[model samples]
Target: MKSAKAKATNYKACLALEVPAYVAFYKAPPEFLGDDALTIEVKYQGGRTEIQKITVKVSAPGGQQKI
Candidate 1:
């Protein structure tokens, strides 16, 4: 499927009775460690918009490994 970018103000006249669905994926680099964050902007069909910030912590694996 193709993705299109549209402005929220353009759909101000539109409305939705049901919630929309979204799919997202995230992966950290193998050498990455410490604090990470993700910022997300959500636009509703009614033209309302919301911004969310999520923080994530990455640390080295603990415990012993057996062969």
Candidate 2:
């Protein structure tokens, strides 16, 4: 029984929370990144859910690569 504008309507959340219904895409892997091994795909369109991975660790000095 927590209606009535939920106490004057005022709520907040953290950790980038935004995916009401559908819409979650981040395509950024085309900026002269030779070797071609860096890609981040986070898409959600309807049922079948299980997404929680955003890794990107590219160390310098000619070593380390996890994307």
Top candidate, metric lDDT:
1
**lDDT score of residue 62 within candidate 1:** 78
lDDT of the structure predicted as candidate 1: 0.63
Candidate 1 lDDT by residue in tens digits, 1-67? 2244433443556653333356454566898877788888888889999997877676677733221
Clashing pairs in 1: none
Candidates' lDDT values, in order? 0.63, 0.42
In model 1, the runs with Cα more than 4 Å from the true position are 1-20, 62-67
TM-score of each: 0.54, 0.25
> What is the number of residue pairs that collide in model 1?
0
Those runs of model 2 whose alpha carbons end farther than 4 Å from true positions after fitting are 1-46
Pairs of residues clashing in candidate 2: none
Residue 5 in candidate 2 has what lDDT? 24
